[model samples]
Each structure stands twice: as structure tokens, then as C-alpha cells.
Target chain A: MLNIIACFKWVVDEADVKIDAKSRALLMERVGYKISDYDRNAIEEAVRLQEQHGGNVVAATVGPSTAKQCLKDALSRGPERADFINDPSFVDLEPEQTAAILATAIKAKEEYDLIICGEGSSDLYAQQVGPALAERLGIPCATCVNKLTLAESKKEIIAERKLDDGMEVVSMPLPALVTVLPDINTPRIPTLKQVLGAAKKPVDNITLNDLGQTYKPCLQTTGILAATMERRRLKFGADEKNILVIIGALLKEGVIA
Target chain B: MNFNLTEEQELVRAGVREFCQKYVEPLAEKVDEEAYFPMETVKKLTEQEWTGIPYPAEYGGAGADYLTYIIVVEELSRACATTGFTLECHTSLASYPLYKFGTEEQKQKYLVPLCKGEMLGSFALTEPGAGTDAGAASTTAVLDGDEYVLNGSKMFISNSPVAGVFIIIAMTDKSKGTKGLSAFIVPGGTPGLKVGEHLNKMGIRGSVTAEVVMKDCRIPKENLLGNEGQGFKIAMMTLDGGRIGIAAQALGIAQAALDESIQYSKERVQFGKPISSFQAIQWMIANMATDVQAARFLTYHAAWCYDQGLPYSKEAAMAKLFASETAARQTNRAIQIHGGIGFIKGHKVERLYRDAKITEIYEGTSEVMRMVISGNLLR
Candidate 1:
């Protein structure tokens, strides 16, 4: 019986984020947050493994108190319980800081056979948290895992890692950490019943004070600028000659290739 | 008063909106083009337990409030009015009455599975001869010992062909007029109960509609819903709730039209400038925006009144009437903004245009709505 924990982040929905052209800044006033896309796969895999084997799946996240909304969103995806580390300081934690907090929460929360995380968050794509978390917990960890299955004896997990060269298979004993790729599984949307059931699921809140980690930033100095797209503002009359010119330009540009 | 949605309500909207965008929106065009019932989406919704929102937890419901129900309807209708129509029929028309008026045994046998989405529920009230005059139902229900034998035919029965359970209105004593009307819980495919072919419609085609013919359709005495003479009151009360559903559907349709129009105005260029810059287009867009907002206020207010246990029949009627008319007008302008493309087939604006018209016709007609409002005020 495996007790699994899926670590996720509530990140701004990029679709709703607007870029300020003049200031080169990202405007987040109208943006809403969602469970990071890759984290969805991690959650699905945890739930899937639990369904296949008899166990419990707990979803854990680090974010502000407003992120309590994520509790229902994640639990609806089939997790039995949730551990939320909600603190104002959690808003902009570096990868290592995030890893330390998650490790502390996991250690304090439950005894787990496996832990899962996305390769990286949608916002940063730093890809550092999963390995750093494993190091913090002193567990063997695998990254870029696209496919995973438990051995028949349920002693260890066999994971298929997706690398640039090709697929690599790795096996490790219990109490391991695996960072999942998006292709690992297509996450299922919570049905009406699942959404309703989420309301009944138990959620525990862990504070920054509970983690007992002194907040210090090892990574310094960051700057962000919005990338702007330049498009030609060419216009032509809707005549046969203009139509031919448009087709010729398209052909020359190999757009019609 | 606190007008902002609660945190939970906001979350429900965000979750349902995401679901609709990912799953419901893509298939909406195909459902309209093929006039398909969207069984897959329906199955998914049922499996997810969305079919039972606003019901109690003990009876297989989500235990969500009525406001959540409105949000679900609004979001679904924004994607496809047919889906909204189908869910409304199930929630308000079919299952709601059973939940409100059914005996404990009836609730156990029917309401539980209905909330669990085991089978689609349908309501049959409109007859060939009776549309607005629900009290004038000619369908007869005769008490024959252990069973009540029904002989009647209903027209424009939504979900008739696909329904697993039905709430049928029949008259036990014609002399008493509307007071004589009674409701029955008739299981679908019962002996002598025939569901006719799917009726082709101009809008909301994705929801199946058909005629229901009952020829000596016999149900046990226990199947009779509410008291013998309370059918008219029950049907009216059911419709009072249903008007909110229809109004929410109309709000969704209008909101979609307004959204499409705004996007189109920004993208569509003419005379070396986007059409949105023109004051003529701006005026139309402005009207549409205001109308959509006003309708939302009316619809949400009615839903709130219902939830608060306030007398909301007049408010619901006004909301339905205004929202449906606004939807018709907004869709018309949405097409104008899209120019020739909006009129052409395969356009979302075109589909919404067709879908918008039915909201005014069904549940309670715009004319009936006015009568309800005026009657309430005059009294």
C-alpha cells in the first residue's frame, strides 16, 4: 500500500495575463491562478497509482492563503486529502526554499511511500525543485519520468524517463521521489460528483512558522521583460490586383509552401 | 448587501468555466451541425455528479446552493444552449418537483438516482391543445383500483426520447378545472407510454425533444405526485424555478454574443482600420454590453430571491422576459458586427442567434412572462 503525495503550485493563468507594452511589465490584476499544467499530470499519476493499488493520495501545495481555493480544485481531481502550506512569504520562494518547505511539510504530515512533482512550475520552468526536494529528504529521485508503474511485489517503482536521446528506464526502492513529465498522463477533469466530493475532503493548513526554516534568498537580482511581437501593418484594397499581390507576397515568403 | 460571489461560488465558476472551455466549447459546433445530443458530455457531467447540483448530500446531490446551479447553467449555456436547456429540464422541471412534493418512498426510489445522475429526468406538461394554459390540460387520469390509468398526448416534451423518468400532468376531475390537475411519476418505457421521434428544432437542437403519448399508461397509486388537487400549484411552482433557469440560459447566450462581437470588432478591419474604432460599431457594442449586464443583474437577483425564500415569481418573470428579449437583440447585433460571416453557416454567432430565439419561447413565453408580472403587480 503506497501513500503518495503530489506537490503542486498555484500559478497565474498565462492566458489571462496581460503584458504592459509601454512599461514592459506583466499586469496580474485581472489574472486568475490555476494548478500548474504539469502538476496536473503528477496529481493524476498519484491518483491513478492509488486507484490501482490500495492507498491514499494527498495533494500538497505552497502558496498564499487565497490559494485555499486550490484545495477544492486539487481534491476534486481525486486526492483523498490536502496539505496546504499557506504563508505570505510563500508567494516568491526560490526553488531551494520551496523544496525545503515542502520537505518539512511532507515529513510532518504523513509517512509516504512515494512523492511526485512536475518537472517545473509553469511560471519559472526552473526544473530545480523536484531534485532539490529529494536531496532535502535524503531519498533517491528520478526526473523527466513520463511513465511509471509499481512492481508486482509493490516493493519499488519502475519509471520511464524521457530524455533528449531517447526513453530511459530506471527502478528505485520505496520512499522515492519522481518528477513527472506532462506526457506521463492526460489528467482527467473532475466530474460533477468529484467536484462535490472535494468539498467533503479534509484539508490541513501548515504555516511558515511550523516549517522552522529561516527565510533567506540564495538567488539574487532578477529582471523580467515582456516579449513583444512585431507585425507588418500592411493594407491593400480588396481588388483582384491586390489579391494577386497578396498571393505573390505569401508565395515569396514561403508561407504557402 | 454583499453582491460579490462567495469564494466557493467564484471557485465553482472558475472550475466550471475551465471545464466548459476545454470540453464543452469545442464540441458545441458539431453538436449544432449534426443536431447531436452530446451524449458524451452529458455522460461525463452525470459521472462527475454535476447533474445533481443544488440537491442535498443525503440524496446524491452536490449540496450546492441555488446560486451555484445558476452559475452551472450560465456557463454551460454560454458554451451550448442545448446543454443548458437539457440540464434545466432535468433539474427544475423533472427532479425538482419530485424532490419538493414526493413522499419519502418516492424520494428514495426516484430522487436519489436522479441526483446521482443514474438516468435523465423529464417533465411533460404542454399538450397539443395547451401551451400557456397549463390549467386546460385534457389528459385524463382515471383511478382504477391499484393504478391510475392515463390517456393523453403531450407536445414539445423536452428529453422525452432520452428520459428514464418522467413527471406527467394529468386531470383527475375536469369539473374542477385547474384544481383538478394532478402530477404522476411515470417511469419511461412503461407499457402503453410511447415516446415519439425527435422533433426537429431551429435552436437548441442538441437537446432532444419529442411528443409523449400515453394510452392507458398505468402507474401505481403511489406514483401520483403531491396531493390530488395540487397539480396546478405544483406545476406553477416548478415553472417559477424553471424561469430562473431559462433566464440564466438567455443571459449566457447574450454574453456569448457580446463576447464574440467584441472580439470580431477588434479583429475585423475595414478601410485600413479595425471596425471597433468606428462610432457606429461602438454604439452597437455599447448597447450590447449594457444589455448583457442588465440581464445578468435581473437573472442573478431572481436566483437570489429564490434562494432567500422570498416571493420571486414576479421577479423571475421579469428576469426571463428581459433576458430573453435582450439575447434576441444582442445576437442580432452580433451578426451585424460579424457582417457576412455571422450570417453564413458554421459561425458561432449564427448558432447563438438561433439558440437565442427559443429562450423567449420556452419555459414561459415572453407574453406569458408579461402577464405574470402584470398580474402580480395588479394584485
Candidate 2:
């Protein structure tokens, strides 16, 4: 049976973030967290694969302790179990750091035939974790995959990659990793029974200490400011003369050139 | 007094909200305008296992708590009150009595299908002359051989026209007054059982309501629910739980109205700025926000009581009374906030205003709710 692992992230719901008018700072005091948008597709794809081919799907994540809520959410989406690698200092880690931590955690876990991840996290679109983690584990990796088909032997997979110009098809053997685009699948909303059942699913809480790793930051983020746009609150009368004047102004401003 | 929903309950709420946004909200206007039953959406709900959320897994239910069921109703009603009421009637009024009082055989035969959403269920108690005075029901069920023959006519029975099974209340011995009442399970398509044409209503139009007529309709003797004299008690307890669902429905309607008003006031400019800047509109919004929150607490608290296995008759009555009245009052304010636009056809607030009125009158009227609350205290 194929044992699959789906990697996910917990990010602040961007819809709930508020912008301060003067400081251009994001207000996150009351903002809630959700499973990163594309990661939902990753988890869903893993579950779908398991349903089609008899196997176990385990969801894995590395984040701060606050991200514990996401374990239940991932499990409710049909995963058989969850692996949470939590450390308060893991918040806002660089993509390379995240990949490093994930590699360590996966090495400590059981064997896996395949691994799936989102093309990019909702918070950071770096698109580096999947390839970096694959390099760490010395596994073949494909990025931007929108479709996947398992070989008859269940030891190989054919993937369709979405590119800017066209789609590319590639085949990889078992024990490979793929970063999936959102178009891969529409995630199913969990029924109430599934939500309740998530409570009974086993979750492994692994701390950095358990991995026997000392954290060192290779990169640091200084600040993030909201982009502000200025609107020209121009109004003109509906009369013919004013309309002509407005047209002249628009022409002078090069808006109608 | 931990005032937080469990993690599972929260997840259920989120899932239901997402479902309603995609499936329920898109069809709401058409449902209201055409007075068409949303059989498609109902089927989707059944597929989600929402038809029997609070029942046990062995019985084909979701095995969730009553509070989780209440959350589902609230979120569904937020998108479409008619759809919400349809589910509430099926789960709270029809399926609940069976789960609470049915024999093991009865549950296996009827409750299992109801929980699985294989068949829709209905409860019939009110007659033309009965209204709140349920003891005045003149329907009779006389034993004959291996069956009981039911003769009666029920009015304003929700889900009657489309129901697959029904819980009928009738007198087994009229000389005993309310004590003579008995409840029976009558499957659809039974001989001599007839359902009248659907009734057109002001609000919640998509939910079908009709009259049920029985002329010597005979059900198996095993179809009797509970004991013969226990029908009144069964109905009263069932309604006590059903009121929590209705209250949740009312809270959903009120929340929808407030949501519309808040969004409309912010975008609708008048004079020099948005009407929300005016003190009058702001005050209305403030009152609406407060009232909706209050109703939510009452409704959720009642559901919590039920889940805790506590006596919540008074709590349920209070919730139904307050939430229903709050919905009616807030929807009116919501219309006023929208000016003439709210009165126009196709506007959400207009439909919500109409939908809010029924919450005050159904299950139990505001008068009956007050009587129930006061009676609990006086006794």
C-alpha cells in the first residue's frame, strides 16, 4: 500500500487583515488563521490518491504552537493521521529553514511512497520548499503539477506541469515529491461526522528538541508594509461645456492619449 | 461557564458556512420569488449527512451534538430561511420525537431512514380548531384487528406535501381529555391518507406547508409511538427541543438582515456622504448589531442546555420568543435603512423582512412562548 504524506502551512486569513491608513501597517490583532489556500489542494490530492489506491495519507506541518488547530482541520479533510513539528520560534521561517525542518521531521517518521505540497504557501510565494526538501531527501521532484496519474505498477507517476506558455508532462519513479497547483482539485468540505472523527485520529506532536536540532536563522525579514493607492476624487458637471472641459483635462493629463 | 464552542463544533460551522455560500445563497432569490421547493439543495444537505447531525452513528447520523445541529441550522438560515426551516422541521419536529420515544423496532424501521436522509419526515398535531389548545383535537384512532384506524384532518402541517413519513397525533379515548391522545407513525402512500395542495405564504415560501386529511387511514398496531396517553408529553418535549431550532433560524434571519444593512449603509451615499455617517442610521445599526448578538447567545445557550441533558423548556421558550421578536424588529429596521430599494422586488432585505415574520408565529406563537416561560416560573 502506498503511504503518502501531504505538507501544509497555517497562514493568517488575508481577508481579515486590516490596513492602517497613516502607518500603512497591517493590523492582525483580530485576524484568524486558515489552512494556506493551495495547501488545501495538496491535502485533497493526497486523500484522493489514497481513496483510489488503498493506502494511508498522513498530513505533515511545521509551524508555531498556535498552528495546532490546523492538525484537526487537515485530519478532517480525510487524512488518516497528522505529524506536527511545532516550536514557537519556527514562526516566520525562511523557505529554506522550513524545508530543513520538514526534512528532519520526515526522516524521523515512517516510510513514504510519495510526498505532495502546494506550489507555494499563501503567506509566502517563494515556491522553494518542495524542491529544496526534495534535494535534501535526494528524491525526484516536479513543480507546478496540475494533474497526476499513477502507473499500473503503482511504483511510478506521470505528472502534467502547468507552465507560462504550455503544459509539460514528466514521469517519475516512486519515493518522489510533487508541488501541486490549486487547479489540481477542488477540496471537499468536511461533513460534521468527519469533523467529529478527526478527534479520534492520531496526531504525533514532535518538537525541535525531539529532532535534536538547534535552530539558526539563515535569513531575516525586516518589515512588511501595506501598499497604498491614491484615487483622484475628480467630479465634473453633466453639462456639455463641462464635459468638453473634462475631456481637455484628461487629454492634458495624458490619460486619453 | 465556558462560552466557547468546541473545536469540532467550530469546524462544523465553518464547513456549513462554506456549503451555504456555494449552494444555498445562489438559489435563495429564485426560491423566494418562485416559491419553489429547493429539492436540489435539500439533496445536497442530505449528501452532507446534515439531515441527522445530532443522532448516533449506528443509526446513520453524524453523531454530533445538538449544539452542532443548531449551528448548521443557523448558517443555512443565514443564506436561505426557507431551506433552514425545512431542515429544522425535519430534524427537530419529526425525527426528534422518534429518537426520543420510539421503540427499537420503530427506530430501525423509520428513524434509520430519516437519519440517513433516505426519506423526509413530518409531524402533524395542529387541527383546524386545536391551534395551541392541542387537547381540543377531535381526531380519533380506533383499534381494529391488527391495525389502528386514524380519522382526522391536520392544518398548516409543514412538510406534509413532500414528506415520506409522518407522526400523527389523535385521540385514543376522548373521555380522558389530553390523556387520551396517542401518537402514531404513518408512512406516506397509506390508504385513505391525503395531503392537500401547498399553501402560499408570505415568507419562507420555498418551504412547503399543507393540510393533511385522514379518513380511516390504518397503520400497523406497532406504529403507535410511545404509550397511548403519553402523546401530549411526547409532543410537549419534542416542541421544547424544536423551539431551539426555530430560535436558531430566527437568529440567522436577523443576522442576515443586519449584515445587509451594514453593507448597504456603507456603500449608499446620501447628501454629502454615506448614510452610515448619519447618527440616525448609525444608531439603527448599533441596535441591530446588539440585538442579533443577544439572540445568538440565547439560542446557543438553549442548544447547550439540550446537549447537557438539562431541563431547557423555559430556556428554549425564552430563546424562541426573544429571537423571533428580534428578527421581526430588526428586519423592519433593515428595510428602513435601505430606503425604497429594500422594498423593491429581488432585494435581499425585502425577502428577509418577509421571512422574519413567520418565526414569531410558527412552532409556538409569541403568546404561547410567554405562557410557557411564565408557566415554568409560576409552577
Candidate 3:
């Protein structure tokens, strides 16, 4: 049976993030954290695979110590156990730093036949950690995977990558990495028994000291401001001439394309 | 002294909320409209061991406390009151009696499956002639050597159509009045046990209720729930626990009404601003929230008392009285907040309004609750 690891991130629930009108900074008071959206798809895919093919699914995540909450949530979604990398310093880690830390932590824990990740974190959508971690671990990686299947011999992973123009079919050898899109599958809401089972599942919480890894951010964000859209309150009568003018303006602005 | 939920309790809420939103809420309207019992969802609930929330793990239950049962009932009712009604009845009314009074063999035969979700249970204590006066049951059970022949009719029995196990109360001795009554374990398909057509209900339409007619229905002497003369006491004891479940159900309905009102107030625009900005709407919302919280505390406290093995009849009565009335009032105000739109059929508020009234009437009526509370205090 395949031994797979599903990676996840805990992100602020964006719905609760309010914008300070004057400072344009996010108001994070009373905010809650949830497993990153697409990361749930990654976990769900892992669970589905385990259900179809007898295997062990372990959920792994790297975040602040508070991110321990993600372990129960992931395990509830059908994983057998969880491996949590908790470090306060990882809160603002750049994608490369996150990948390095996760690779180190995962390697220290156990060998896995496959590693699944969301295409990117919901907050940053960096699309870097999966491929970067794969590179560090020297395993082939696939991104934007919409459909995936394991070979009968379990030596290869066949993935359908969703691209801008068309879908690309690619196969990576066993012990590979694949970052999935949200469309990979709709994550199931864990049933009551599954949730209770999660409480009993083992969670291995690893710290930076446990991993014995050191990472430094290579990219820095100076600031972030909320984007505001201003709608033009244009009033036009039911006339052909006005409509045509509106269409022309839309065409010039590339809004119609 | 701790008001905060334990991590396990919180997990129960989170897990149930997610499940109800996906499985129960979507079917609420369709069930109400078509008057269809949701067997699939019920099966799913059984699979999750929710049917046995407050029972023991050895009996194939979740081994959860009464408070956990309250939480499960509250959350389930919040999404669909009918489902809440059915679940609470099955847990508190049908299964409780067997669990509390049945012998080890009886527990093994009935309570185990009831808690395991393998079989659904119903309490057939209510009769046309005996609504609040449960001791007035005309149903007679004659001792016939090895079997007791049951003959009577019961009205307004919840889960009668779907339940495989029934906790039936019948008179074993007429001179004993309430004391002569006895409860029995009658499994479905027992000859002479007939389930009548489903009665159309104002609310909780999805939970099947019907008349159960027993014409010479015979069961082995071993099927007796408790001693022959202990039926009224058993019924009263069962209703004491049953009231808390109904209270939780009412609290859930009231909470849903308040929640809908809050959401509606924000989205509904009036006089160039949201209705929520109006002081009048704000006042309604505030009052509704207070009532819901009060009902919740009452329900939870009663459930807690039961969990601690304390005398909780008065508390349960108080909780049911307050919570059921709160539901009725809150649903009315919820409808008022929605105005004409709320009165329209198929509207969530309208359904809630209709559903709220039954809480005041069933299990124990508000008047019965008052009597129970006052009588206990006077005693």
C-alpha cells in the first residue's frame, strides 16, 4: 500500500479580514484560521486515493504553533495520522524557506511514496513550495494537477495538469510530488464518526529544533494595501446610440475581450 | 463553573454543524414540501453513531454525555427541526426507557441495537384519551401465561411508522390507576401491531407520526420494560429526560430564527438603508438573542443536572417551558422582521414559525410544564 503525505497550510479566514479604509491595511481582529481551501482538495485527493487503493494517508502542515488546529481538521478528512511542523518563525516564511523547512521536517519523520500539496497557499498563492520541496528532495513534481491516478504496479503517478491553453498529461515515478488545483475534487465534510476518529488519531508535532533545520527568507514584502474598485455610475437611456458608445468604450478598455 | 465547551464537545459541534449543512439543511425544504422522511440522512446519522450520542460505547453508542446529546440535538434542529424532533424522540423517549429500566437481557436485545443505530425506537405512551394524563392510558396488557396480550390505540406517536422497536405503555391492572401501568418492548412486525397512515402535521412534517393500534398484540413476559406496577413512574421519569431534549430542540429552533433574523436584517433594505441599522430591528435582534441564550443556558443546565444524576424534573420542566415559549415568540418576531415575505410558504421563517408551535404542545404542554414546576416547588 502507498504511504502518502498530504501537506496543508492554515490561513486566516478571508471573510473575517476587514480593510481599514484609511490605512488600507487588513483588520485582523477577531479573525479565525482555517485549512487553506485548495489544501483541503489535496487532503481529499489523498483520502480518495487511500479509499480506492489500500494505503496510509498522513496529513502534514508547517505553520505557527497555533496551526496545530489543522491537524484534527486534516485527520478528520480521512488521514490516518498527522505530522505537524510547528514553529513561530515559520509564520512569515518565504515560499523557498517554507519548502526547505517542510522538506527537512518530512525527511526527518519518514519516507513517503507520494507528497500532495495545493497549487499554492490561499494567502500568497506562491505556487513555489511544492516544486521547490520536490527539487530539494530530488523527486519529480507536477503542478496544477486536476486529475490523478496511481499506476497498477504503484510505481508511477499519472496526473492531468490543467493549463491555460489545454490540459497536459504527465506521469511521475513513485515517491513524487504533485500540487493540485481546487478542481481536483470537492473536499468532503468529515462525518461525525470520522471527526471523533480524528481525536483518537496520532499527531506527531515537530518543531524547528526537532527538524534541526535553519531557513532564512530570501524575499521580502515592503507593504500590502487593499485594492478598491470604483464603479462608474453611468446612466444611459434605452437608446441604440448610447449602447453602441458604451460597447465601443468597453472594447477600447478590453473589458469585452 | 466552566461555561466553555471542552475540546471534544467543540469538535462535536463543529463536526455536526458541517454534516448538517451538507446533508440535513439541503433536504429540509424538500422534506417539508413533499412530506418525505429522510431515510438516507437517518442512515447516515446511524452510521456516524449519532443515534446513540448519550449512551455507552459498550452498547455501541458514542458514549457521550447528556450535554453532548443536547449539543447534537441543538445543532441538528438548527438546520432541520423535523430531523431534530425525530432524533431527540428516538434518543430520549424511545431508547431511554429501555436503557434505564430494561434487564440486562432486554438491554442486550433492544437497547444495544437502538443505540447502535441498527434499529430505530419509538415511545407509544401518548393516547387520544391520555395526552397529559398519561396514567389514563386505556391500553390493556393481560398476563397470558408466557405472553402479555396488548390491546389499545395510541395517537400522536412520533417515529411510529419508521421505528423497528417500540416502548409501549399499557395497563396491567385497572384498579391500580397510574400504578397498574407497565411498559413493553414490542419490535416491529409483531402481529396485531398496526401503524396507521401518517398524520399530516403543521410542522415537523418530515418526521412520521401516526396512530399505533394494538389488537391482541402479544409479547413474551420477558419483554416487560419494568415491574408491572411501575409504568406511570417509568413514564414520568422518561418524560423528565424527554423534556430536556424538547428544550434543546426549541432552543435550536429559536437560535435559527434569531440567526435568520440577523442575516435578513442586514440584507433587507428599507428607506435607503439596511433594516439592521434601524433601532427597531436592532431591538428585536437584541431581544431574540437574549431569549435564545437564556433558553440555551436553561437547556444546558438541565442537561448538566441530568448528567450529574441530580433531581432534574423541575429543571427540565422549566427549560422546556422557557425554551418552547421562546421558540414560539422568536419565530413570530423572526416572521415579523421579514414582514410579508415571512408569511409566504416555503420561506424558512414561515416554516420555523409553524415548527415553533409544536414545541409548546408536544412532550409536555406549556401548562403541564407549569404544573410540573409549581408542583415540584410546592412539594
Give each prediction's DockQ, rounded to 2 decimals.
Answer: 0.44, 0.76, 0.45
- Model 1's CAPRI class? acceptable
Pick out the ten consecutive residues of candidate 2 chain B with the lowest summed lDDT. Answer: B5-14
- Per-residue lDDT over B1-379 for candidate 2, one digit per residue giving the tens place of the 0 to 100 score: 8988888888888898889989999999999999999999889899889999889987778888899999999999999999999999999999999999999999998989999999889999999999899999998999999999999899999999889999999999998989999999999999999999889999999999999999999999999999988888888988999999999999999999999999999999999799999999999999999999999999999998898899899999999999999999999999999999999999999999999999999889999999999999999
lDDT by residue (A1-257, candidate 2, tens digit) is 77999999999989889999789999999997888999999999999999999899999998998888898899999999999999999888888988999999898776999999999999888999999999999899999999988999888989999999999999999999999999999999997678888989999999989989876878767898998776667788999889898998799878897
lDDT of 3 by residue, B139-238 (tens): 9999999999999999999999999999999999999899999989999989999999999999988999999999999999999988989888888899
Of the two candidates 1 and 2, the one with more favorable DockQ, higher being better, is 2
The candidate 3 chain B region of ten consecutive residues with least summed lDDT is: B6-15
Once superposed on the true structure, which residue ranges of model 1 sit more than 4 Å away at CA?
Answer: A107-110, A197-200, A220-223, A231-257
Candidate 1 local Cα displacement, residue A219, angstroms: 3.8
Instruction: Summarize candidate 1's per-residue lDDT along A1-257 as a digit string, tens digits.
Output: 89999999999889898888599998989998889999999999999999999899999998888778888889989999999888976777788888988888888867999999999999998999999999999999999999999998798999999999999999999999999999999888776557667888999889988887766779875877888876666677898899988888788878896
| TM-score of structure candidate 1 | 0.92
Question: In terms of TM-score, which candidate is stronger, 1 or 2?
Answer: 2
Chain B TM, per prediction: 0.99, 0.99, 0.99
Clashing pairs in 2: none
Native-to-model Cα distance after best TM-score fit, residue A77 in candidate 2, in Å: 0.6
Best-matching candidate per DockQ:
2
